[model samples]
Structures are given as structure tokens and as C-alpha cells.
Target: MGESDPFIQRVQDVMNAPPLMVEEKESIQHTAEKMVDQQASSIVVVNEKQRLHGIITEKDLVQRVIAADKKTGTAADIMSASPYTISRRAYYYEAMSSFLMNGIKHLPVVNEDSTSQVVGMITLSDLLKKQNRGKFDVLREIEASSSESLADVKFAIYEVLGHLIDDGIPILHIMKVVTNLYDRLIRHCTELALEEVKEEIGSPPCDFAFFLMGSGGRHEQFMMTDQDHFLVYEEPAKEEDRQTNDAYFKKLGEQIVYWLETAGYKRCDGNMMASAPGWRGTIDHWEDRIRTWGLRATNENILLGQNFLAFRWIYGSEKVRDQFVRGVSRQLGKSKIFLRRAAELEKNVPVPVLDHPIRALFRVKKEGMDIKKQALFPFHHSLQILSAEHGILGETPEEMIEHLKEKRVLDEPFADELLYAYEVVLHIRVTQSWDRYKLEEENSSEVSFRQMKSRDKEALIQALKAIRSLQTKAVATFGMA
Candidate 1:
């Protein structure tokens, strides 16, 4: 049931040999005739350059053109614009899930080459013919459920983790799936919370955005992760409006946090949640605060800047997030002192190893080694400092590393080595968290090194060495040492 299952095969493996494609401007009648001639149920619509544009299905023709009696319409008019497409590299289960989610029978498969051109087509019939009804059926159920609580989805996520881990998938890719699903869950929670808030106190007084910071924002999160959120709304014009907006947003934040806890996502122990008054405010106020942090560059302020550098919008208006991001970027451009302080903060924090005999390499406690503070944070903070120095802002560590590579701030080989090292640390941390999750332990970052295999311990040692190299690079870059 693991790797032998045909359902786990790539979508391209089961897709039709050649995709039936039609130009977007082709007449609906012409498209229909082409489909009929080819015995195809759907036609992928492409642009002049042969890139994916949309799709035209037989159902779309009958419903939109025939039903409306618009016989003269073109495929562009009747086709579903920007239709959901699966990558040729994606698994059959993912394509199947996409089909269920979009309620579409035919899926256009696109290659990941330079043009992202259409390659083939897959259908519900094709997937059903080979897919195992076991795990894939469970995924479909979890997706289609209407339950308010995330308990069901949480279990489903764990099931997916087990399958992926057992299948020998790379840790980096596994964590990507984990974080993506969790982000979607958080967005759904926000949607539900907003609905309740609207019902109770009427519509929001202004536009607002919800953001994730720390590990979740960095997309470095795995099992046993907690919530670290930020909330910002449009400035109110009047005192009365301000009062109402504050109350509405505060209630919304509290409700969402409560729901997240109920669904097993723990609240941040440091009180960094949006429910805290310090973390929720108008967009201008948040911008001013970020500006102040950059100008001051104090030890405390530098810590705050480090955390805020990981900010990513989870839900709400992109404009709001973009404004804040631009402000941060501008501030970084002008604040060399702040960048220097951030570089200084990259120094390691020595957390004592509690149970493990090998205290030199890792900081272990009751749960185990402090993977985050010792391993992840050193590399993360170093990259952030370098990014700020170059006036580059990245949402994830990988992005930051790539930017550094592209900017020639770090040699390609060194950047590549750092990336590999980061992945090694992240993979071990995620696997450890999965183990703790099986024991129903509280969300924690520490892992016991005594339990690890010799090869894994060796890998951890190598990663720590890579982090030290990065730290030296940061010091030299910022003249901090």
C-alpha cells in the first residue's frame, strides 16, 4: 500500500498520451467539432505561445453556449477562465483531490518547463480506474467535510504525514505539504471566525489582514507547532468608528485563537498572538512601529525586528500586507545600524543539554535537543541579517538563501551547502516532532539525541558546522565581530 499503489503515481503517468488542445479564440462550434472528432471530453485552451489559458469542456459548451443559445460564441467566451490545472510532476492523489475540490471531471496537466506548456489531460475516470480507495478516499472525506472544528482534518494531516514519511519522501517536501495544509486550515479558521464576528457585531468597520510570524510565517513549521500571528486593519476616520473597529477586531482575534486551540494548535507562550492588544492595530500604526524599531536598533528592538522579518499574510487584503512590507524594506534600506545589531544577534544561545550525553553539539532538555534555537535560529538569523544588509526581504529561509545566491552575496557552492544543511536540520526536527505527536506530547522543539541513529547524529553535527560557517560569514559581512 505504500509505494506500490498506482494511486500514488504521478498524474502524467495516467494522463492521456497527448492532450487535446484548442486555441482560446476558436469558435465554440469548432471546439465542439474538434472534441467530437478526437473523441475527447475536454479541450485545453492555449494562447498564441501555447501556454495554458483556460479549458473548454463538453459540459461547458452544453451549459453555457447551447443553453444560452449563444451559438456564435468563441471558446474564450464559454471556457472556464484560469481553470484549475495540475502539474505533470504532481501525484495522482493530488490531482484526484483537486478534481474533488473543484468539482471538475477533466484536469489539464501542465509541464514545469520554461513555458509551463500543457502536456496532457487526466480525467476522473482515469484516476478512479487505478487509484486505491484507501488513503485517497480518506483525503477526499476530510476535504469534503463541513465540520467547524479541525480535529478531523488534524488527524487526516497526521495520516498524510505517516504515508509520506513511510514512502521515503524528502523531509523538505514533507514539511512543505505540512505547512501548506496548516496554512489552509488557519485561513479556514479565520474565515469562520470572521463570519461569526460579522453575525454578532455586523460587518467589519474596515479592511484588515491576518499575518503569521515566526516558524509558521517562515514556512519552516512541522508537527507540534504553535500560533504566532499579527493583525492589522485600515485606519478609522472617527473616534466612534475606531472604538467599534477595535472591539470587532479584538473579538475576531480572540475567537480565531480559541478555535485554533480547540483544534489542537497551541497559542504562543510569549503572548505574540493577535489577541494581544500590542500585536493588533491599524496599518499606519504597525508601519510606524516597524519604522521605530529600525531607527532605534536597541537589543530589544532588534529582537522584535528579527521576528517581524518573518511576517507573511495568511488572510485578508494583499495591499495591506504589501504596504507594511514596503515600509519594512524602505526602513532596512536606511538602517545600517539596525542591520549591524541584527547581525550581532546571530550569536548562539547556549541552552544546556539536560539528558543527552553529547552536550557540545546540541542543546537538549526533557523533550530533547533544542533544534530551533540552537540549529534553526542561528542559520535563520544569519540569513535574515544578510538579507537586510542587501535590502532583500524573503518570507522563507530558502527564498532568502536563493536571493543571496542570485545577488552574489555568497558564492554558489557555499549557498548550496547552506541550503542542504538547513534541510538536514529541518528534516530531523520534523521527524522528531512527529514522534512526539504520536505520544500526544505538548508542542515543543527539543529532541533527545540519545535516541537518534549514528548517521542522524553525524548529520546534526555537520549541520551545526555549516551554521558556524554562516555565522562567521554574517559577522564579516556586517563588521560585527
Candidate 2:
């Protein structure tokens, strides 16, 4: 592509057309000088062949070196390694999507011919400036405000979503942006809770991990659904210490829940919030609970394990989360009967459509088709069972698919097909949920077949078939068929 290419206003047109190069071994001071000389916000570290090594941004320098009072280090010492990169041929929207998905400011534009060759750099700020200002402004407002302003920002989000839908952006992409925003909102609430707790009780008595379960855990959540979370903390050494720690963490968890509810997040109906005593516990207690659940092999236990295992840490210590994951995996792996019982749970999810086209068209729409209960559940539930049996806890559906494929638990074309089907179903749910929001109704997977376009109906029917196929494989693999 030449400088005067027709797509002059595109990302390809402006992305480091000449390329800014820096050696990985160069001193931070030297890199700083180069950035200043070029009037650039970021400097790309590259080797002799122009292969990208990492990137050093102004934020990285301020946070890692300057804020930490470190005066000496190579660019490699502070640069963000294995940074997100885009091809020079990619469009500006693709670059913007990457920025939102990865939560990164700067991205290196690489050569299309050779992926490793860095050609230019782009920032989210630059891309946003070039794009339409309306939706981007909503994102900016949400990011800049905290709980005090979340309600107003949410109003803006609704407007943004309507605009995006009207513009015909894909449902999956819209959900991705919405999910990212929710993650940020959760973090902001957590921060506020932490500060309040600190003021009440000098400091945390011990390390703890706060995590979300269910859709939020899987990174698939779109709307402001009910929240499900739990807490895991290090076991205290003495009786008095244990009591002190419990009191502090319990109060902290309550504060978080309260703040989240205040910010419009509905509390979990199952009482799975960290504020609940059952969901807040020492690491040893959590391990014991998992061991008991595995031994019981009961329906409720399996359901509980299903929700708990699909968790993502939001705050506090990583070690606590890691230890809990290993413990749950070990306990579940030791029980063969538990795996089979869990796999059998898929039989409970009713198949809402048939493979035969005419029969599918005649499919009943009682309370509409629950995309979650009837479509996504079979796949998510079955995968959760397989993951538990294989001791593969804490993986998203996509990650689980890859792991299962690698283990020969599922084969090629089938795996790809299933992943695609999963994406389609998720997209349908988001679109349906958006429709509900537009009607000022509750968001749910239950969208009427009558409401869908002919193509959407076809896609939904195909998704049902895919779920059925996976359910068959799941039961057979676990000796439940």
C-alpha cells in the first residue's frame, strides 16, 4: 500500500507508515529521547530483522520506572512484552475492536507479509478521534466515572447500544464491548469497597480472592444480570486470628455487594454472593466443601460444582484462586461416579428444535425459546462435566473446546463446528436481549421464534442441532449414554 492509497483515512493509511524502531537493549532514557524526537506516544522495540520484541509506552514508563523510582533499566525491563498487534492491511474498526477487547492503549501495526515485522503503531485515543464521536463518547464517560455516576453512564450505554444495533454492528461485537464495560464497572465497585473496608479495619487481616461465577465468569455476560460471586482467603493461624479475619472479610464482602446493588447490579437469587457466609470462607473450608460435593455425587452438588468451577478472579490474591482450583479439580477427578452423574445432567436440558427443517419450523415457542436454558445450557453444562472429569477447572467454553480437542476428547471438524455454533448462539442471545431492553422488558434467552427473521430462525435451529450433537458426544464419553 502506498502513502497516497485511496483508503488514506483508514488505519492502514496512518499506522506507522514509516515504522518507529527501537532496540530492546536500548536504555529507558534513550527510548524516552526517541519518543520525544518523533513526537510519538509509544516506541516499538524491534530486533535486527525488524521483528517486534515489545512496546514501551508513556504509561509504562511513568508507572514502572518513574512511579517506582527506578532510574536505570533497558527498554526490555519495562516494556509490555507480547503486546497485541494488528496487520497493516486491517481496517480502522478492527484496530478499535482490538483496543476495546484487550484494554490496551497502544498497538503495533505489523507487516502483512511477515507477522513479526513491526511497521507502525496506533493508539486507542487516535482511533477514537477518527471514528464517529457518539458511541465513543459514551465509552469515555463510562470509563472516566465511578459508582456515583454509573446510573447516568448506563443511560448513555442504552443510547449507544441502540445506535450500534441501528448501525447493524454484529451482536457478538456489541456484547464484547458491553461485557468489557461491565468488567470495568465491577472493578470500580471493588476498589470503592476495598477503601471503605480499609477505613473501618486498619488493613486486611489476610490475603483473599474475589471471583465471579456463571456468565460473568465466562466473559459472556451482556446485560446487568444478577451477580454470582464468592471469596477465598488464606486460613488464619489461630482461633482468634481466624475470627478476626472472618469478621473483616465478611464486612468487606457485604460492602461490595451493597455497592454493586446500589449501582444497579441485581443480587444473585441463589445467594451465591461473597456476602453470604456459605460463599465466603477460608481456603481449607473451600477444599473440604469441594471434596464433600465430589463424594456426594448428588444433583444439587453437581449443579453447585458446575457454577463454582466456571469462575474468574476479579480481585485480591491469585494464589488463593489457584489453590482453590487445584483442590476442586483433584477432588472431582478422584470420583468416577461423580463425573458420570454430572454428565447425565445434560439429559435434563430439553431439546427445543429438531434436525428436520419442517419440524424445526413447527417448533413450539412456549414462553419463547430460551436460548440459555434450551440452547447454550446443554453445551455449557456438558463441557463443564467434561472439564471437571479431566480436572480442567476455570476454563471458558472456547478454551475448554481447545483442551478437549488437544486431548482427543473431540476431533477437528467437529470441534470447529461446535465452537462456531457456540458463537452463533451467544450472538442470538445478545440480539434477543437487546430487543428485550428496547421494549423495556427484562433481558432473557427466551426470544420468540416469531420475532426472529427467517435467517435468524434458521441459525437458531442449527444451533440447537449442534448442542444436541455435543450432548450425544458428552454422554457417550462419560458412560452416561
Candidate 3:
């Protein structure tokens, strides 16, 4: 690869080496003089042992020293402590993502071996100058998007997805990167909605957390994502205070849904959005609902409970989110009957397309099979129940599978087979989804048997068979057989 190839270039190739460094006790005036003398925008502040302690940027000098008139302050007092740093050997795209996701301009580079040792630094300007701006324009657009401009950012996201796929990046890696972009977009929408809500009503009554569900929750979204989110707020002490908090969160949830729709995300067809009464509630209410779902374990309740099991906190108070999660886990731990029922329900699900021989392609028909429902759902449902039983929580199926293996629930060979099968199915689903998205199709998970390459079709069939075997194993393990 040439020097201009951005994909293959490492961070060391672009960073400023022998970065200007100053001791933590150095005066602010001296740090400023070093920055000016070096003609650098930022300087790394190190301890006496020459380990990274903090970073002092020109902005720090201007705002912390000159504007505040703290002329006698040392570098340690003015610098940003424990600033984000990148490995010298990381790919350039990783550095770009760090810059885009964190909204930071200057990223300190540390030695790959001893992470605390400062090695170099890379600025956002350096990235823009070194790589093609068109590739990163979507990230910049997302950062700068308004309510009206977010729709355009959605399209730019598709472009980036296509580029990543063409560049031969692993499907899971691409999903993570794309998920980060979507998370940022959701956060932006949430901020906008909060501003509107605060202006309409006073500030929030208490701390709250907004979390995602379904694909967004699992960090598995690739294209055509819908709103599957909920809100949990701190319980109030008095009746009147509770009423006020309810009203405040109700309006906030409605505004969040509205802004997300404006940004091109569709509303949940199952009414799983935060705007719904069942979805948004006080922490106590959520706990009650979880207990109720476990006790009842009706078909509808089980479906809802299963979806809730994958909840991932995206915004707000971590303490509140942790409280909710821990409560649910405790409830699930005692609900052995509910977990068995969930496994039993999944046992009845059949991989219809895989039930017949590949030569009997007529079974798939011209319309194609819904790969997500027929292939992926069984794997997800089985693993979800198993994980919940073991008190393991993860954001993705791969993570859950790894956790299961760690707990000795799955042997090494079986876990490896399941992981490979999952990857094959997921890769096809994502790529086909992108193809359908480009054609403006509504359904993203359907795969036409006729259009699939012979090898992919065979691999998918094998994957589905493996999923079926797992489903059977789940039933036997749960004593449902």
C-alpha cells in the first residue's frame, strides 16, 4: 500500500513524534512558552517519572490562565487530567472514530507497550489533511446536524456503510462503528428534545435514564432501525411530587419520539417507544412491571419481558440504570418457571427453509425467506434465556455467547460452531439489508434464495441447522422436552 492509503495506515505514520512534554509541576506560563516555541497546539503533561499525567492545550492557557487570571497555576492545575489517548499501532480509522465519537480535537498518543508513556499526538486537522474528507464527511455532518439536517445525515450514513463493506472490514466491526454513529445521532436527538422540553416545562423533577431496546440495545443494528427505547426516572417522595414528575417525563418522552422520527427513525410498530405509558415509568414502576411479567409469563408478557432483557442504557444517570438492571436481574434469578416457559416457547419455533433440502428451493418461493425471523431469532431467544438464568448481561449475541462459554454452559467446540454460524448469518443479513435499503425496500431481513450465491446459500443452510441444534439443546437442558 502507498503512503496515501488511509485504510492501511497506522496512527504512528501520521502522529507528531517526540511530542512536546512538560512536567506536571511546570508553570502555566512555561507550558505556554513551550507550546509557542514548538509551534504546537497542545503539550503533554507528564509526572516526574515521565508517564502521561494530563494534557494542556492552547485553549487551556487562554481560558484557564489568561481569562481566569490564574497566572500562578501549575500545568497540573490547568491541564485536562486523564485525557483520551490512542495506541501508536491502531489503524487510522480508529483514531478518526475516537475524534468523531468523543468530539475531541487533540488526541494524545501513548506507547503501545507501556500505555502510560507518552509517544506522540494526532490532531483532527492532521486526519482531515491525510485522508479523504469524503469518507469522514458523514461523521462531521452528524456532529453538526440540526433537526432538519439529520435526515440528510441518514443518507450519508448509508454511503459510509457501503464504503466500509467495499473496504472488506469485518461485519461485526462495521456494525460496532455504525452503531456508534447511530448512538451519537440518538444522543443528539435526545439533547434537542430535552432543550424543547425544558423550555416548555421547567427542569426535570429528578434524575432519569433513557435506554434502547431490541436491535439498538444489542448494538446489532445495521440499517432501517426503529425506535425501541424506554425511560426510567427516580421515584418521588410525595404524591404531588410523583404527579409532577410523571407529567414532566410524559412530555419529555413524547418530544424525544417526535425528534427521533424527524431524524428519519420510524416509530416502533409494537409501541415499544418511550412515549408509551408501558415503556416509560418511575424506577419503582419498572420494577413492579418486571415482577408482574415474571409472575404472569403469558405469551404477551413473556415477549415483552424477553425484549426488556436486552435493555441497554444510552443516556442519563448510570446509577438509576444500574438500579433498574440489578432489580430485573434479581427478579429473573428467582423466576425459574418463567425462564423455562421462555425456552419452551423458543422450542416450538422452526427453521422452515432449512427443514427441506437445498435442491427443494421451491419452498423459499420468489419472495424469499425472512432470515432474521427464521434463522437469527432462535439463536437469540435461546441465548437470552440462558444468559438471564446465569445472571449474565451483554449488549450483543457474541458477547453473551462468550459469557456462556466462560461459565461452562457451552463447551469450546460448540461455542466456536455457534459463533461461526452467527457470523455467517449476520453478515448475509446485514449486507442484504443494505442492498434492499439502497433499493428503497421496506423489509431488510428477507433473503431471496435464487439471488444468493451457491456457497452462501449452503453456508446459510448449515448455519440454520446449527441454530436448530442449539434450539433442541436448549429445550433438553431446560427439561422442556
lDDT of 2 by residue, 68-185 (tens): 9989989889888888899887756457656765788888988789878876788888766655544355556655666678666666656655655666665555555556567767
Per-residue lDDT, model 1, residue 384, is 84
Instruction: Assess each prediction's global lDDT (C-alpha) against the native.
Output: 0.77, 0.76, 0.83
Candidate 3: pairs in clash: none
- Where does candidate 3 have its weakest 10-residue lDDT segment? 1-10
Each prediction's RMSD to truth: 4.0, 6.1, 3.6
Better of 1 and 2 by lDDT: 1
What lDDT does model 3 reach?
0.83
Question: Model 1: residues >4 Å from true position, as ranges?
Answer: 1-17, 47-53, 65-73, 87-94, 111-117, 137-149, 236-244, 295-299, 348-369, 439-444
TM-score per prediction, in order, is 0.85, 0.79, 0.87
Model 3: per-residue Cα lDDT over 236-295, one tens digit each? 978779888998999999999998998889999999998999999987898788778878
Ranking, TM-score, top scorer first: 3, 1, 2
For residue 347, model 1's alpha carbon misses the true position, in angstroms, by 3.1
